[model samples]
Target: MIDSIIFLIKTAFKNVFKNWLLTIASISILSVCLIVLGSVMLIVGNINLFIDEIGDESQIVLFIEEDLTVDEITQISDRLHSISNIGNINYKSNSMILEEYKESLGEDAWLFEDLDAETFRNSFVFNIKDLEKYDQTIYEVEKIDGIAKIKERRDVIERIVDIKDVLTFLSFWIVMIFVIISMVIITNSVKVSVYAKKQEIWLMKYVGATDAFIEAPYFMEGIIIGLTAGFIAIISQIYVYNNVLSPILSDLGFINPLNIDSVMSVIVIGFLVAGAIIGTIGSAYPVKKYLNV
Candidate 1:
């Protein structure tokens, strides 16, 4: 059994190298497929990250009248906490807001020295537990005592989420289209390789070579091609992401930038999967057509 397996591997490797054009063609197609898939994965990851950032920054700040005492504010805080969908209440004191503006102003901080934060608005910041429950959360918080106003930006968040959902759906179809194209390209390339060796294949069959004996070489070649394509695609993506994508995104002030490690992992997995599927399907057509029993 071991001998048979070794023979198959050796034959496959020899054939993969011997048919230089087909081997290269397979690798190229696989590389393109992997690259496309990697791009799709990165897009999805970024959209998800953006959605998260939007959610984090989405806080409903309610401004109360300064006449309210500390006990009244705490009373408001407790009521906000009592609501079901409300995650937590962050009370920004008059002094805290003043300090923030002072930091922002730097030397100009003295401009606001005569003023007071209480003159603006003593706010109760509402963080929702789930974005889907935002409207309901706001409706509940409005009923609380000493809560002057709520600026829950529901429309903005909903619009962004809806657009992203559409993009996510579109990505699925795009992925399917590319996968089909990859399969077709690999299949045709392998078929041509098999056709070139038609005479040898016939002779081997006549001399009692089994179906496995004939097909093993193709399967093995597929594995080799697949692995190579996947690895190369991963490296290429990582380079492009760091050198190209990162700089552009940095200019836009996106947080933490795009993580190369995550992108690389996605690329690697996509390529490896593409390699296996392509090689297997590509060879299947040839085996069915030429290697009967």
Candidate 2:
């Protein structure tokens, strides 16, 4: 078995170099596909990170009637808790609200120094778990008796949600298209490799080589192409991300670009698996077509 495996590997390597042009072409196409896909993954990852950061800061501020007693406030809090999508609800007294306003002003806090702390409205801040159900949550909260006014900037959230949805949709279609193109390119490359070795393949078959024995070398050849392409793609993506995208995003401060180190394992494993599969399938097609035993 070891001898057979060694022989197959040797044959695959020989064929790979012998048909160096096809191998190079296959690697180039596969690498390009991986680069495009990896770039999209980075963009989508950062967008998601930005959205989550914004969401953490986003809140629904329900300014309740200032005169409500402790029991009334507790009842309102209980009602908010009953909502399934509400992740967190914090009650802020009038004094707390005054303190927040003062902090926001910093040195200008003295401008409103004469005003009484009791003048500010008591409120509850609601952190929503699911943004899609925000409107329904708002409607339910509005029906509560103590809520004087509901203050939330849904415009920004809505716009971000729309953009995220569009990006996700587009990325899916783009990935599918690139995968198809990669597979097609690899398939043609393998077909050319097989055509180059047709006489040798026929001679092996005439001498009673089993189907698996005949196909093993081609499978190895495909895997070699895929693995090489995958590594090239990963290296190219890391370089581009650090050199081109990171600088721009770092200046923005609000957007957190993903660290290549953090996501490297996932990228490497994902590409390796995808590359192997593409190569195996690409080589398999020609085997079925040409090696009819």
CA-only RMSD, every prediction: 4.7, 3.0
For every model shown, the clashing-pair count is 0, 0
TM-score of each: 0.72, 0.84
- Model 2: which ten-residue window has the lowest total lDDT? 284-293
Candidate 1 residue-wise lDDT, 163-193, digit = tens: 7778888888887887777667666666766
lDDT of every model, 2 decimals: 0.75, 0.86
lDDT of 1 at 47: 69
lDDT, candidate 2, 1-293, per-residue tens: 99999999999999889889878988999999988898888888888888877776898889999788899999999999999988768989888888888899999999878888788888999777777777888889889998899899899779878888999999999988988888887778777778888888888889989989988888888899999999999899889889987777778878878798999999999888888988888788877887665
Off by over 4 Å in 1: 61-89, 92-124, 128-150, 203-210, 253-256
User: Alpha carbon lDDT of residue 152, candidate 2?
Assistant: 92
